[model samples]
Target: MTSQIHVALRPLWLCRACAAPWPCATARLNLLAEYRNSHVALSIYLAGMLYTAVEDLYRLNPQDAPKPTALHDRFLGWTAPRAPRPQPSD
Candidate 1:
């Protein structure tokens, strides 16, 4: 288990812990490690957050349209593919 915790900052949706983007490098790494076998759950969780972030940020920056691809890449993308699950011993 990791000793550190990464929290998100509002409006900008940056990392409160590292002050980088929310789910910043450290947060993303930790999330990947923590949810190694639960990729789908992680994706769902991130997607939910991404939606909320979009809504909040959109209200703040109405003039600049947010790109779905870019937002996905930033908030929930960049994760490495999961490793194969361990097989049970006979």
Candidate 2:
């Protein structure tokens, strides 16, 4: 069987599938598995989401907002990019 969509719950920022933090343990595992061969795309997608989450979260705490570094690490800093593919020769 397939897994359900694991989007964030927003506001509270929990995982829709597991109810953990957004990009929670289960979501992270599934993301890595799905983009195992294409980490760049995953990075791009996460970066975009990070931007949106940051914006929304900031509106909620304009004075006590989390640091950019913290948010970056939480959203996009954990994973490294995928390795390059080998070229085929004739």
- Residue-level lDDT of model 1, residues 1-90, one tens digit each, is 756568788888888777887888888888888889998888888888899989988898988847878898987767655578999999
- The lDDT for every candidate, in the order shown, is 0.82, 0.83
lDDT by residue (6-54, candidate 2, tens digit) is 7798875678887876888778888999899998999998998899888
State candidate 1's TM-score.
0.76
Please state the error at residue 82 of candidate 2 in Å.
12
Model 2 residue runs over 4 Å out of place are: 1-5, 81-90
> Could you report the Cα RMSD, in angstroms, for every candidate shown?
8.6, 8.1
- What's each prediction's TM-score? 0.76, 0.75
Best candidate, TM-score-wise? Answer: 1
Backbone clash total, candidate 1: 0
Score residue 31 of candidate 1 by CA lDDT.
84
Candidate 2 Cα RMSD (Å):
8.1
